[model samples]
Target: MRKTIIGLDLDRESSQISYYSERSMEPETVSIQENQDRYLIPTPSDLFTLIEGKVELGQMTLANFLKTCIGYIGPSVKPENVCIMITMKEITLAWADALRNACQMIGIPGEAVFLQTHRESFCCYTLNQKKELWIHRVALFEYEDTKISSYIMDIDYHTKPALVRAETGKSINLGRQGARSQEQWNEQRDARFLEMIEEVFQNDTFSAVFLIGDSFDKTWAVESLQYLWSNRRRRVYQGRNLYTKGACYAAMQRMDIGKRLDDFLYQSEDLVEHNLSMQMEHRGKQSTHMLINAGTNWFEAEYTCEFILDDTDEVVIYARSMMGGEAESYSIVLKNLPERPKRTTRLQMRLKFISQGRCKVTIRDLGFGEFYPASGKVWESVLEV
Candidate 1:
């Protein structure tokens, strides 16, 4: 089945989410004449204004825009059939909650939300056989909850080239210094990282893995996988491998969760059954009836049981003597007693019984246990028929 994929990028100031049908073409920018004065690179403030009232406009705000843009931009294609890009910088918990709610509201469903954190990395290449300029890009490091030591390294790749130039006025070779140094860091903490990745592989049913973000760091993630099983001599499965060849935002736009997202949202039958059992136990406890006034305080002596039967016929009284008092006594009486005196039925009846010091009384019917005040209060029926 075609999956509905939604990519969420949580930023410091504003958040961005990209939603598209799995079968539809990737969303692209269209040159609209409405605002030709606006720059190609839309400012964060402008994007914020556009998205504000537009959220209430429903998926049409995105779907209509994408349809219009794609129509205008013409038939643009990619090397890979899947992936969509989104850019945003909001990082508040409120935004996170809103994004989650919005996805549900849009009928996107839970299975389609593919969440990833972005990291910055660099790539050096010759543009048109001219000068070699370092391309600053964002890389996505897979968020493995089990990986304790692996840090999401978001190095400002743009600043790194300048810093390298300032430190050494000659050509700065990152492959020798930076990349090698990173490999060393990985060597020290590689085992723990593998354990984390392994835990995720075991726990989650992810069909395809999209290594989105910096193109250069993608190599590091792939290389690190080798280091993991090399020491242990275990083979890593390579069925689904997706490499995003663009910035974090660009890569997010092209990502697809496919059917995996759907599986993530729905619980297994076993889990549902277990939850149902727990609910039944909770409901049973709440519905079970118990006489609250039957129990007495800890300071009382021996208690009495007197059932005042009105016109209602045949009331079987079951009484139990509370254990663990000054007098260690516990009794269970299951007997049908005679009806009380005519006028005396309306008055409170005090059973003429006395003990040593303090005790408690427990009374029960067809339902559950009920404790009453042993000495302070007596059972009285105000109903006279």
Candidate 2:
């Protein structure tokens, strides 16, 4: 059976809901009333007429009209198929409790509720070394017949920094001060960001990770996260699949919310494993070599290589892929190596691949004229090479 997924973007002042229908491959938006007391509620029109000098209804008299509109729309929807999206700030213990009461009143099951928060950070800052305002955001999701769920909650304290001194006088320093000599303050801010991330992870078993925000530089946040997860050694929690993208574009592409959710949740494990194994093999094959795979499909285009011999005796590799016609790459360099007195040399390599099509990559060690393909899934070839 086809399922309906609803994506709700809720803000402090208003809310928007989008519903994706699989059969029609279309989305529909439902109108929501601003005030709660306008529709279906009883009001003595005679009393209002008496209060008003004119025969026409006044602005205050519209309260009952709005209530009637809500009442008419509320009964038409099936609570079981509804999914609610709300911001993290919108959700509170009280709101959850109130939602539960509302569900009970409507004969809807609380368990059917699902929540999601948008991952985008909306706050901004300047470059004058001044503190700005703190903006908090939360997004919640729920099915029509269930309780509310929060998808993402993010809080950002914005600040403007003094622009870096440059020959061109370009404003280089922007946004909040991420790292300072005062390590205590840095730690406090980092902890808050991590807490927000952990809250989303705790809410559901996320199949993908979407990084969203408006800041020009996210290196600090990403680095802090790397440090946070670097020491985590448990395999059960170690293997996580993440897909990062911008929030606005993701929303635009996710016309079918149900399909998007399903796709994110059930990505292929085999593909991930194959890519990782391919990287290990290529790194083990050569001291300094460049391997490029070019194709027409996302699964086919990939490039990876390593520079093993440098003055620093470090392994450097770059990899990238052209998935969906977008080229993305990453490079890593490692330093220091052992000499061959005991033939004990530490080997490391980095590789990057960008693909526009599906292609198989094979790495061969070329000793002047001879070539040998590294074989094995476990990456033992590093010691041999």
Question: Could you give the C-alpha RMSD of every candidate to the true structure, in order shown?
Answer: 23.0, 25.0
Candidate 1 has its poorest 10 consecutive residues by lDDT at 270-279
TM-score of model number 2: 0.24
**Cα-based TM-score, every candidate:** 0.24, 0.24
TM-score of 1: 0.24
Q: Candidate 2, residues 1-385: lDDT per residue as tens digits?
A: 2323343443322333444444555444434544443211233445333323433343333333322322433565555544332222223333333333444444434443333223221111001002221112222222121112223323322312211110110111123544555455455445555555565555433222223222212343454356334533311111101101112222323333322322122111112112222223344563323344322112212344432233342322333431333333332222222232221232333222222222333332221112322222122112100
Q: Candidate 2: lDDT of 162?
A: 15
lDDT of candidates 1 onward, in order: 0.28, 0.30
Off by over 4 Å in 1: 1-8, 13-93, 96-183, 189-192, 198-212, 215-223, 227-385
The runs of at least 3 residues in candidate 2 whose Cα sits more than 4 Å from the true structure, single-residue gaps closed, are 1-5, 32-75, 80-90, 120-257, 260-385
Predicted candidate 1 versus true structure: per-residue lDDT over 1-385, tens digit per residue = 4332323333333333333433444322223344452213222443344445445543334434333322332244221232333223222223333443444443444333322223211110011111211121111123322222211111133432232110101111122234456667545444444455565444322222223222223344454566433533232222101111112223333343221111111111111110000011133353321221222211111233334333432322222223222322223232442243332232122221111121123333311113212222222221100
Candidate 1: give its CA RMSD in angstroms.
23.0
Predicted model with the maximum lDDT: 2
